[model samples]
Each structure stands twice: as structure tokens, then as C-alpha cells.
Target chain A: MTEGSSVPQRCWQIDSSRKGAEIIRITDADGKSLIRVKPGVSAVIISSASFLEVILEEGARLELLRPFLLDQTLEREVSLSVHQAKDSSLTAFMVTKGSISFKDNVSVVLAGEGAEVSLNGLHDLSNACEAHSLTLIDHVAPSTKSDQLYKSVVRDRGHSFFHGKIMVRREAQLTNAYQLNKNLILSPEGRVDTKPQLEIFADDVKCSHGAAIGQLDDDQLFYFQTRGIGREEAARMLVKGFVKDVLLKINDPLLRAEAGGML
Target chain B: MLNIKDLYASVEGNQILKGLNLSVKAGQVHAIMGPNGSGKSTLSKVITGHPQYVADSGLVDFEINGQMVNILGMEPDQRAREGIFLAFQYPVELPGVPTSEFLRASYNSVCRHHGLEQMDPIDFDGFIREKMKVLEMDDKYIDRAVNVDFSGGEKKRNEILQMAVLNPRLAVLDETDSGLDVDSMKIVAHGVNLLRSKRNAMIVITHYQRLLNYIKPDIVHVLYQGRIIKTGGPELALKVEDQGYDWLIKS
Candidate 1:
């Protein structure tokens, strides 16, 4: 059995601590890979049950499968700032389905000529649970870009917010960026707010943003019903389709299947 | 076989179909002709289970496979599964859902209700290709969104294409030829004529006799004041075209 297939348990747990915690660097030395989340590294963090600061160098990749659950009072911080030298790529997936408090944040800074980064995450809040995720991507070089697509489904007074800012410096010309945030209010009183900002000081760039909030399609419901799909099954299919679009993009098939089972 | 008895329906608190009655049998075509505000379109809507129209009191029964079935209590989707298809006057433009996907979903839905295995993509492609060839429609319309960005003639042809694909037991077309040119009108009628069979019935609703000139309905009913005021054979449509509804209104 692999680490992903170990448990179906739930609890409130914390990560371990680190020594000399000023700025720790995990590098993919000559022909090696960066962005390490192996058992050795994660065990150190999970065992410590505390906060730490980490920095990532160029050509590094990481995969976050389980929740980075931090206790509510600790207010832990994890910052990842990457610089792609030339023709490098970075991808990450954050999957959280439970109530996790403690002010978790991800601060990303990109600096390279032809670097691309895709940050995608999905949080499912149901049965009076609360989860918050804050993501920031900064562009510090020209001809570099980033894309963000995030979705949330909240039920029974659950809350979700995604505030993303794409900062194109005055000298960062010929940059391309896009951000999309969509939410489905499963209950009448549940709420969600999405804000996408483009602060550009350069004129030779293309940027776009959008936000949509609505209920399910009534005609689609009737269409399914006429075909003998029960109301609850139809609703489940729509909701699952909405989230599967993001989770299934992960390159690791094991992680993708795990997410599928969760749904 | 289908029957409508003393149907009354309204929309937004205004009555549209008042005490309408009609009956259609297998291996037959009935053409419904009327001027504007004569409740011709409303009759079709109420029969097809459109939610906008509220049925005050009416009964629509269909004898499917020699069994009488009441469709008044069924939803539109249920009505569709039970083999009642409405070729809309205005086909909806579904933006993201591809035509092939929509067709397969609709086809499989009805198939599943009848206890049949769903057709895979490979089989469906061949099936739709043959049907499209019969209609002389471009192959591109098969993969594109349903009626999205289609020309007026193209939309009407698409309605006929769906009729051929679903092959419903009964088809009711509402003003399908209002916007077509002469060539498109012929193509539309040809497509409909090809699909007419003894096991399936049809009701062609239009204001002019031009479409009837192509498909040739077996009977024509003149609708005025939300009711069928007159019924005649195929010659009646030609008479209405020669002497418009103005004379019929006076009589």
C-alpha cells in the first residue's frame, strides 16, 4: 500500500518544527529536481506541528495531496517564491475538503524570461465546515505569465473567498495572464466572493478576469428528469463535474484517483 | 394516435389556448393554419409540455404501441421519452454542449427508458452521418453547438435533422417555414417527407400553403379564436392561400 492509500481517518493535527529556521532552501542539484514533498521532508514538518519558512529555486516542482492542516491558534505561514531561468515550468495542486483554520497562505514570485506557472485548488465545504485559502502570484520579469482557475462548492453556511492579484511591473512587457473564479451556492444562505485584480504598469500586455455566481440550470434538470435520472442524482452529477475539472488536471494518476474517490 | 380535448391554457395570467380540440392518427399529416394571435403556436406548446403555458383543463392522450397513455401529467422530458417530439419554431442555441453530445444524450435517454444498450460514440457517428446525408445537411453541423450561429434556413433544416434523428412516434412542427427561402423551403419539406412513415404521425403548423405544396398534408384545419373553426382536405390549404384568412374570419 502506498502513502496515499493508507488512511480514511479524520482529526485535527499539526506539523513538526525545523532547526535554524531563517530561510531553508531545497535545490534540485545538477540534473536533480527541486520542490521536495517526500516522506522525509513532510515527516519533519508534520512531526513538528508548527510553522516554518521555505524557499524554492528555479526548475523545482511540488505536489500537495493532503491538506496542510494547521491548528487554528498557531497561524502558520508557508511561502514559495520561484525563479525560472529559461523555459521552465511549475505546477501545484492543493486539495482540502475539511474545516482547516490557522491562517494558511501561499506567496509566489516568478522571475524568468519564458517561465509558466499554473496554480489550481479546490475546497469542498459541507455540513458546517470552514476552510480558507489565500494565493498570490507576482510577476517580476518580462515575457513571463501565470494562470489561475479556482472553484468552491459550499453547503449549509460554508464560506469561501479567492483574492488573486497579477502584478506586471513597469518593465514587464509582453506578459499574458488570466484569472477565473466561480462558485455554486448549494444552500440559500451560503455566500462566496471572488476578486481578480490586474495592476499593470506596462502597455504591451493582455489580461482578463471574470466572476460568476448562479444556481444550477433548471432546463438541464428537466432534461435529465425526462430521461429517468432522479433529482438528487442529477444534482450530484452537476456538482461533481464542476469540481472534477480542476482536480483531474494533476499529472500524478494516483493523486488524481484519490481525489476522485473523495468526491 | 393522439387526441386533445377541450384544452385551455394560459401564460402570465393571460389565456392563449381557449377550449382547443384536435385528433391525429397514425400514417396521417394534419396542417394547422391560422393568422397571428389565433393560438396556433400555443396549442403546440401546451401539447409538448412547455412550462410557460399553464393547462387549466385539458386531456392529451397518445396510443403508443396500441396502448393509451395520458401525457398531460408528464414533464417535457418525460413527454420526450414517451415519443412526443416538438420541432421548435425557434431552435435553441446551446453554446457549450456539442450537437453530437446533445443528440447522443437525448437518444440514449430514450433508449435507456426502453431497456436498450447505449450506443458508443463510434456507432452514433455512423448513425448521424447517414441521417445527415439524407437531409443533405453539411457534416459540420453534426459537431457544432446546436443551432448556434446558424443561418435562418440552417436553423429550420436543423429542426428537421433532429426530427429524423429522434424519429419520434409523433412530431408537431410550429411555423418551421416562416423564414426560409424557396430552395430552403423545398429542402426542409423534402427532409420531412423522407421521415414520414406509417408508424409515426405528424402535425405541420404554418400560416401559408407553400410548405404543404411540398410535403402535402392529408388534412388542413383552419384555426381562429383559439379553436379549429373549419376542417377540410388538402385543397383547403390552397383555398386559404388563394383567399386569405380575411374571408374565413367573416364567415
Candidate 2:
């Protein structure tokens, strides 16, 4: 290693708690990187947008928390790709807070037997912020499983877009894949567009996908009001509850509680 | 604690309650029994200040802090803070609002209304578990989403549980015994009976007299075409049970 070099370090380290906690920031100089998870290791990586190619070794587990939360007005596109080996698992939580525009594309390929992956995302937008997501999961081997849920809460003039696709190959017998996308539009001006696609070539594979976009239930609002909650507070509770389950996937309790208050 | 006089209400240009008049004292139980489309449920909505149910004219007043204030002029939550509760016949299912959190919010809202200290989640956990004993309910109900996937009986018990927790001045049980089995009815009636006190009043609205067999009322009123037609003792329910509302509507 050259001390005067401008190249960033690529060393991977594990923490003493056996659960790796890291913050990987994406900068202009480091526009791309390759991540190889060691076998039988578990780690949690918190990162922002960059070109990330992750390969999970056999029996390895990884939790990725990618949050595109910005204070300044900006627009950007992010791409993430992952490949899984035998008996490996990965869960990713991608959150997009209000912004000018955030275009996120995520792809995963389960190439070995008994591999599993669960991916969840939440996008809360207001003040004309725009969010777009395209996710694809491919089951390439037998006995692979994938589950995904993505949700968005839009208010004011904000708009959200989601397109999710899953593919099961002919050799991927006994494969299971499920995908769901739900969006809540809180105002008349707010809008949501969602689409789910599933392609299966294996007869023994189980695959399902669904998408729903709507507003909060009026009956629920009245129920809360009858219990002495004001209309504004009731709406807040409903909005928070709409995204609570998706946020609960964050493995960190403190961060989960903090996220509950935000979009 | 409640006074209703010549109250006329409508929904979507359809008049449901036409000049309905009834008076509830602070320490009395009133049972309003009537046939379908007789404004029994509309009257309940009028008191709770439901937005769709418009009160075209007349007065619905409750004694709030020793002043006879017309509650129809207040917001729904304001009326609720003034000690009015309605146990919904079909409790709305809240998918992500935990029962414990909902109960605490309700209890603390009432406390904040009356200038009392609000209990945090930890203390509220113990406070609510103690109240759950009155309904003979399993403690797991506190962990679930409110009324989501709960059976009819469980939902009723949960309503009664809320009533027990809030301890409101006026409680209107609208057809609470419609879908309950005998055993479940007894449990619900037991919970409701336990909450009965002189400081608070109850208005039990039911189609059948079976619920009255457990939580007996002091006065029974037969509502027909949005007005109380007959007011009698407990035997009034028995007579309605035996003869139905045909003779009452005629006379």
C-alpha cells in the first residue's frame, strides 16, 4: 500500500460483536466497487448510492441498509447487483427520503441451491420530490427463494414509481418467489405508479406478485377520532402505521424507532 | 348527563332521525329497542357526532364540567374528550396500530383532556394488563393489531375492554350482542356490568332482550320512526320480546 496514493482502501474488517457495522459512503472518485462476502460470516453494511457488485459466498449472510436521504436538492441514479451462492441469505432495506429525484435499480441472482433473499424498500416523499425504483430477482438454481416488499407514502405534489420483476429458470424446480408493492397517496395531488411482473419457466416453482396503490381508510380515521384523537394526529398515526411494518425490517431497534418518526 | 330533544338528522339527503327525543340521567340505564330502519343506529351516530350523520335541527346536550353544553356543536374528538363513548358494532381493523399503543393513546388522550399525567408505555403495559382481567381476555390481544383478524366475540370483548379502560361518562353499546354466542355474551355482559357506576351512565341498544337478561336496564324505550313511542320498566323489553313491535307501532 502506498501512503501518498489517492486510492481508497478496500480492506474488509469484522467487528468484535460478530455483527459488522459499517458506513460505506459513495464519492465521485470511487464510483464502483466489488464486495465478496466470506463464507459463514454475517455483516450489516449501511451505504449510500454507488455502483455496487456483491457476491455472497456459500452460507454467508448480509444485511444492507441503503438510505438515500438528502438535505440539499439533488438528483441521482443508483445501481446495485448481487449474486448468491449455496445456502447464503441476504436482506436489504432501501429507503428513499424526500428529494428532487432518486432513481434506484437493484438486481439479484440466486445461482446456487438453498439460497434465499428478502428485500424491502420504503419511499416517503413530499414537496414535489420524485422517486423511481426498478428491482429484479432471478432464481437460477433449484430450491432458491426470494421475497420482496416495497412501499411508498406520498403527500403534497410528490410522485412515486415502482417496477418489480422476478424470473424463475427451468432448472429452478421447487423455487419460491413472492413480490408485493403497496403505495399510499395522502393528497389529491400526490400520485403513485406500480407494476409487478413474474416470469416462471419451471413447472414446480411457486411464484406470486401483486401491487396496490391507494389512500388511507376513512373508517380507520374515524375510529381514531372516536377514541379522542384529533384528525391531524389520527392521520399521522395512520401514515406511520402504513410504513411501520416495512421499516421494522431494519434490524437495528434504535434506528428503526428513529425512522418511524421520519417519512 | 345527556339530553336530546326534537333531534332531526339526515344522511345523503335521506332523513334518518326525525324529531327523536330522549333524556338520560346521570345514574340511569336506558335500553332502546326497535326494528330495522327505525333510527336506533342513527341516534347513536348523532350523539357521537359522526360527520355523515347531519343533525338538521334540534339539540343534543351533555353536562360537561357541570355546564349543559350542546355537544352537536363540538368536534367528534371534543365530544369524546367530554366523556362520550360508542362501542362500534363493526370495529374497524387497524393493520399496523398495535392494540397496546392504541389503548395508551386513547387513555392518555382522555387524561390529557382532564389535566392528568400520561403514563408511558411501560407503566401502561401493566395498567392495561390489569384491566384485561375484567374481560377475561388473553394478554396476547394487547400485542396484535386492533381488531384485525379478531373474531366477533373477541372484537366485542376488546370494545368492552376499551370501555373499561377509558371509563367514560356515557357509553352506547350499539347492537353489541348481535353476533355473540351465549357464553361470549355472558362474558361481554359481565365486563359491561362491571363498568356500571352511578357517576357514569349506559345506553344499551339491542334488537333482542337476551343481552338485557345479563345487564338489565332501568328503563326501556321503544323507538319507532325516529321517536320514542313507548317508555316502560324492564317488562317492556319482555313484552317486546313476546309480541314484537307490531302492537307498539300501532298504539
Candidate 3:
């Protein structure tokens, strides 16, 4: 159960020595959650909410899996903020499916030295739904690192948006950050919009960002046809292939299987 | 096993093949030599029923079940199931789809078309490995993405590998020699030569007579301005190699 004012709030304090995953459901009209991973501890959090605050103390590690597969029509805006201290690491995975109109905005701050963060996300949208995912990562300390990859498969009239910005401060020398967004539009009616921005004030940093969006390659399809695979089956294999690499990043075998089964 | 008559085809508003005609019986090897933009590749695409290459007025009849049936209306995959293949000049690179998986699916599709049970993975792996050994391709290629990051010669060899795996009856090798080195070309030619038999026909499209030296076509045809200008024995290829296509195109 969550403590609430007008909007329900679910709060959890993952104290030191915590070593397990916790699944929390945000079922209210609009919900917020506060997750704090104490120093030197590791934990996994799976949750759904409109507003989420995640804090990782020194030497803490966190893995977050966010699954949004609700069939209900969700026309809502969600925002997530994450703060990491020295020697902390955060790896987050998100899977969004359904004909729900939802917008997600996430910002991460590597506030202390030697922090690292990685985000892998995918959105499989159908119908006339509209989805948006915006990520802003800031490396504020020296020797910090960040990586982000987001992909989308939009079918029918669904439209997907992915906007990511990576900012490395002047003091964040020796930083390494990269971002890539790939999109697959299945039908002529489907659409994808991507914007990747990198602002670096540090000279001794490795940073790169890219975005690519398109339908399946016609020549690739024809190549399959030349080998006796019909157009429909060829398209299926390619679409399946498009989303597989993201799923492969999952280290937990059971979670990987479950995510694959979702597909 | 394949017949083309009065074929007029175009792609992207350009009429590339105009009134082209050819005929090949089973066990025959036909070498098509032409310069760039002469529609040698267009003919292969037309035979394979490429969607973009429209047949304005022509007939591409393919032998299936001992009958010559018009295949222009059939889809490319249908034409393939009935035994037509094109070894593209530039093979398409498919990322994320491993070579083994794609080949297995392709092989199984052909099997299903002919009413056969699916080949088990173990058997299929062994079968394809044997073919790979002949092409001199490494074991690492199968587990990687098809044609992705492969060297130019390696990509051409991959095409031949597929040809060996699918075993198409009428294979159009479209400049299969362009990217291959001499030694690699010999290996590919050897692999291709082994696949030639009475049950299959081949159309080798090339710009150089060097490839024809190994594949050894029975007939050599000069394709200029979309149509076959001259058809001769294998000696014609040597003559064309000695003298450029200018004399033939002028005649």
C-alpha cells in the first residue's frame, strides 16, 4: 500500500545489505514513488507510476525494469528522475506495449565521481496511439559514464518519439557517454520521430549520439524472397530481429525469457 | 527450363530492357556479358519477378512439373519456390538476422513448398557446414549477421553458399565475380561448377571474360542496349575480351 495526499504515493527505502527485487504496481489515477538504494547495496525495482524519484548512494547498484503493457487507454504524462553518487551504477530497461497514449520524461544526474548508468528501452506500439520518451543525462563529476539506446516498432497509425540529450559538465573530464535511437515503422501509416542531442563542456570525454528511422529494407526483403521466403514471413523475421538485440541485453535469464514471451 | 520472349521491362521510370528474348533448356550454361547499364541485371530481376521491374509486354515462362508456365504474374518468392534464383551483384546486408537462421528458414520454406517435413536443426547445421567448407568460408560467418561486416569477397562467397544451400534449378549469377579475387574466384567457380548438372540451368552474368574461363559457358551472348545483339559459342567471349564491346555495339 502507498501513502497518499491527493495523488497516491508508494515509497520504499532499500536499506544497506538489501539484495532482492521488488515489484510495485501504481494503480491510482496518478501515482508517485520514491525509491532509495542505500550505500553499498544492490536491488532491482519494477514499477509503474506517473512520477518516480530514484536515489542511489555511494557504491549502490540498481537495476530497474519498467513494463507498461496495460490494455487500458492511458493519456498521461510520466516523469522520472534518478540521482547517483560515487561508484554507483544504474541499469534500467523499459518495455512499453499497447494502444496507450503515454509520455515519459526521464533525467539522470551522475552527481559524484565514477558513477555509471545505462538505459535500454523499447516501445512496441499499435493502433492510433502516441508515445514519447525523452531522456536527459548529465555527467556532473569526473570519470563518469553513461549509455542509452532506445528503439521503437510502430504499426498501424501509431507514432513514436524519442528525444535524448547528454550533457557533460566541464569538471566531468574523462567521461564517456553515448546514445543511439533506432526506429522501425511497419506500415505506411506508422510514424517515428527521433532527436538526439549532445552538449559537452569537457574536452577529455568520448561522446556520440545518433538516430535512425525507417521501414524494413526492400533489398533485404527481396533477398529473402530469392531464397523462397514469402514477403510476409520475411517481414516477420526482420521485425522480430529488430527487437531481439534489446532483449538480449537482459542478464536475467528468466526475465529475458519472459520479455521474449511478451513479444 | 526457362524462356523469355519480347520482354520489355523498366524500373523507376527507366525502360532498361527492351524486347529482350532468351531461351535455355535444362543442363545448359548461358553466359551473358555486357557493359554497365545494358540491362543484364534487369533480365535477372525480371526472371525473378522483382516488384519494381515491371514487365510492360512480355512473357517469362518457367518449367514447373514439365510444363512451361508464364511466371511474370507470380510473386518473386513463388518463382523461387518453383526453382529460380538470382545471385545479386550486390548482395543485401541483413543486420541482426544470423546467416544460419535465415538459411534454415529459407531451406524449410522450400521443403514445405514441396510437401516435405522440416529438417531438424542438427541436420541442417551439418548440411550447411559442408557447403560452407566448399566455399572456404569460416565457421564464424554462420553465427554472425548475414552479409554484415563481411569482406567483399566473403559476401560474394556467401551468395554462392546460399546457392548451394537452396539448390535452385535456374540460377542467375549476376556478376558473382566482381568482388572476388582470382583465388577466391576459383574457389567460388569450383563450388558453382560442382552444383552444375543435368537437372539445373545457369545464366552467368559478367563483365569480364576471366570468369567465363572458369565457369565455361556453352553459349555466350552480348547484351547491348537491353537486347541480345550477338549470340555465339564460348569463342565470342574471348573475342569480346580481346576487343572491347565497341565493335559489337556498333555492329
State how far residue A253 of model 1 sits from its true place (Å): 10
List runs of model 2 lying over 4 Å from the truth.
A1-30, A250-263
For B1-251, candidate 2 gives per-residue lDDT tens digits of 89998999998889988888889998788999999989999898889988889999999989998998898978888888888999998888988888999999988998998999999999999999988887888999999999988999999999989998889899999999988999999999999988898999999999999999999999999998888999999999999999999998887
lDDT of 1 by residue, A1-263 (tens): 11453332222221234331222233221121223222222211111212222223344333434334322443333333333443445555555564443233555566666656777767676654555566666776788777777778777777777777888887778878877877877888677867777788988988887877766666555544433344565567567766766775666666567656655
- In model 2, how large is the Cα lDDT of residue A170? 93
Clashing pairs in 2: none
* lDDT by residue (tens digit), candidate 1, B120-165: 9999999998988876789999877667778888988877877787
At residue A257, candidate 1 shows an lDDT of 76
Model 2, TM vs. native: 0.93
* Worst 10-residue lDDT window, candidate 2 chain B: B73-82
The candidate scoring highest on TM-score is 2
> Looking at model 1 chain A, which ten-residue stretch has the lowest summed lDDT?
A43-52
Q: Once model 1 is optimally superposed onto the true structure by TM-score, how far is the C-alpha of residue B221 displaced, in angstroms?
A: 2.5
Worst 10 residues of 3 chain A by lDDT: A1-10
lDDT of 2 by residue, A1-263 (tens): 11463442343433344545443343332365556778877776666636666778888888777777745666778877888999999988888787577788999999999999999999988888888899999899999999999999898999999999999999999999999999999899998988888889999988888999888787787788788888888887777788888887778664565455457
Pairs of colliding residues, candidate 1: A15-A46, A15-A48, A15-A49, A16-A45, A16-A46, A16-A47, A16-A48, A16-A49, A17-A48
- Can you give the DockQ of every candidate in the order shown? 0.22, 0.73, 0.71
* lDDT tens digits by residue: candidate 3, A196-252: 888999899999888889898888899999999999999888988898899887766
Predicted complex 1: CAPRI docking category: incorrect
